[model samples]
Target: MTCSPPAAPGPPEPPEDAAVTTETVTEPVSTPRERRGWYFYDWAASAYNTTVTTVFLGPYLTSIAEKAAGCAEEGQTCADLHPLGIPVAPGSFFAYALSLSVFAQVLVLPIVGAYADRSWHKKRLLAWLTAFGAGTTLAMLFVTGDRYLLGGALLVVSNILFGAAETVYYSYLPQISDPDERDAVSSRGWAIGYLGGGLLLLFNVIAVLAGDSLGWSTAEIARWSIVSAGAWWAVFAVYAIRPLRDRPPVETSRSRSVFYAFNQLGRTLRELGSLRLTLFFLIAYLVYNDGIQTVITLSATYATEELKLEQTALVPTILMIQFLAFGGALLLGAVARRIGAWKAVLASLVLWAVVLVAAYFVPARAPLQFVALGAAIGLVLGGSQALSRSLFSQLIPAGKEAEYYGIYQISDRGTSWLGPLLFGLAYQLTDSYRISIVSLIVFFVVGFFLLLAVPMRRAILAAGNEPPRLL
Candidate 1:
């Protein structure tokens, strides 16, 4: 299928001079080169998602936290941290770090997203945020032997920048795609990102394993992994900046300054009341995605701590999930075409709830638990997230795609806080990982009902026809 570029705003300046200067001008559709370049950003960015956020860095950071808090000793294994210090416990630091990152994301993502939308240099902003995130991730190398504060600080920076970069990245999507092709283009990008992320994560795992076998310190191996993540980010990001063309900033009157941007933002917020479906979907996404994210973040700790899985088993399990996610994303895209994006999303959410229930019942056997959880997550993770992106894309106003997507990012980030907090709270109150796992099902159930209420066709039409606003 082919997509035409959106109609040029305001009828092409009335053809400039209608007299002898009859030079014909054609507006270019987004080219294959530009589309590939745009997709490469996902490829570049996914290294962070797979290696640092999902598979490697969390475990590594938890190790650092354990050591720093004196709950574990060099070359000696220890139990997972408690939910909070709570009068001397092992894993308190882990809970603290997780909570801190969640809190920071909620506070920072919306404002940063709003600023990125109002500003002209989104690519540049993405670059800076990505670099900062990478650098902070790299700084984890220095967090050897119980440096909890340093490790926590690095994680805080990494998480903040990660969220900030994502806000900008999602906002950029509609700016560079025609409406007709957005779904296919977005799906393809997601598929490519999963593949790329899996490949890079495999390489990082090899490095860490080799480093460990060579009698290198865990700290040294971890440092190398951190550096690799940064390198991967920097290298692939080049594609995004090189072939992409920036949209010109909207001209504002002299009366409209930086403060005016805030006024425009306020206006947009007020206008949001009319975009009820969009608002509803945003609320729904917040509830469910937070559950997804919390599961992703905490699964490794659960495997290692509760199931007694070694790093050998845990890392490979994660790598398997990454590779499976590649196929899962593409497969879900096809499923979306068949059943509609909303139904597809609902299906994935239902699957997730079932998976959580199954996880609760899985015996204490590490391999069995890993296999069950891994397979279930692999099926739903990519589908739910990719469909959500496309679904939200359909809901946004046409020329105001960036502005509305910024609001979408705000919803995404804000919704992220609840699940992790719930997981941590469940763990604290019940001291049962099984209960914690089961509790996340509420998010999926609530989000599914809310999503069911959204009018997909209306959203698609609104996104295609709405006028651009300053916000």
Candidate 2:
């Protein structure tokens, strides 16, 4: 995700020499070839999400950190490793790395959007970021033994690069598709991404299962698995960017200030003050999405600590969600085409509320019930998110899509902490994970009402964007 585009006036045109070196069009035109390319980028990027972040990195990094702390096993309790004279727990290494990466994204992504919006070669920028990000992931292959600090640094850098590339990639949606077709396009991208990520993860799972038989150490297998994802990302991205077209910058002037993106980001936030509907939608999205992400981030913990499920069982559940989510994105996209994106998102929120309630009542040590709950989550997960992106695309100013999406990224991609904070507080008070899990209803209920109040067409027009036919 990225920042929302600004509707405020742009700077005057710069000299021809300052112009970006790319073919320019009068306005963005949607084409089937370009759309397919855009979809493949998602497919490429999701490998990082599924393989590195979701499946491999946490345990691998923790194992490295444990080694650094003189522990024999990954999950062993040991003294904190003091890197650069700062104490850090081995178990928390991955979490701390994730936090640091998200912090970097929050600071940099808006500026990335600002520069991207001003450039004619946005696809080129996307390709460069993808390469750099993949390179960082590839470097993970060398993060062996007790190099926990190096592993943590790579994770942070790769994650930031991942977010930056994603921000640029998302900025393409408005330029590549019509307003009404956005739901379908975004949904297809997400579905393809899920498939790609799931396929790689499935392969890795098989590899992990056969590691002992193949006479490979778990560490070696993990290293190869991690690097394979990077290879997959780099290889697939070439095809993704090949067909994407270049669109002319709305504002041709290049800001010379070293603080241009920062300055522009400040201006963008100020501009959002007047775009009430867009702001309202952003607020609603932030609140509810925090809940959705918290559910995703904490689900494994719930299954382990509360349900007492084994790690082996959780792997299959995660795979189930990944594969099913592909269908879910398409399913909700069809619903969006029938009704409207906004309404479809609203309906998904209702379903989210119900899912939380069901989670609260699920029996402890019930694997079948837990599997059923996972299925429910998988069905609603991709649909809600895909529709949210499509719906927000309609609410931002046309020329500033990347910029606004940078702002949007501040809360998107599991960055927001409010929901998790609330969950933690609830658990701390009552020692009941179930109560904490269900407590997220505040976000959904409030978001649903906030969304209800948004006048979609009015917001689109106010943002200087054309309203979708259904909206």
Candidate 2 local Cα displacement, residue 84, angstroms: 6.1
Per-residue lDDT of 409-464 in model 2, one digit per residue for the tens?
A: 76565555576567656765676778878998899999999999999999989987
> What value does the lDDT take at residue 404 in candidate 2?
86
Model 1 error, position 14 (Å): 15
Model 1 earns a TM-score of 0.85
Q: Which stretches of candidate 2 lie over 4 Å from their true place?
A: 1-28, 63-91, 217-220, 256-258, 301-311, 357-366, 414-442
Q: Every model's Cα RMSD, please?
A: 6.0, 5.3
lDDT of each: 0.68, 0.80
On the 0 to 100 scale, the lDDT of residue 230 in model 2 is 94
Can you write out model 1's per-residue Cα lDDT over 304-376, one digit (the tens) per residue?
6666676667777888887788788888888877667778888899998888888777666558667868977
- The alpha-carbon deviation from the true structure for residue 268 of candidate 2, after best TM-score superposition, in angstroms, is 1.6
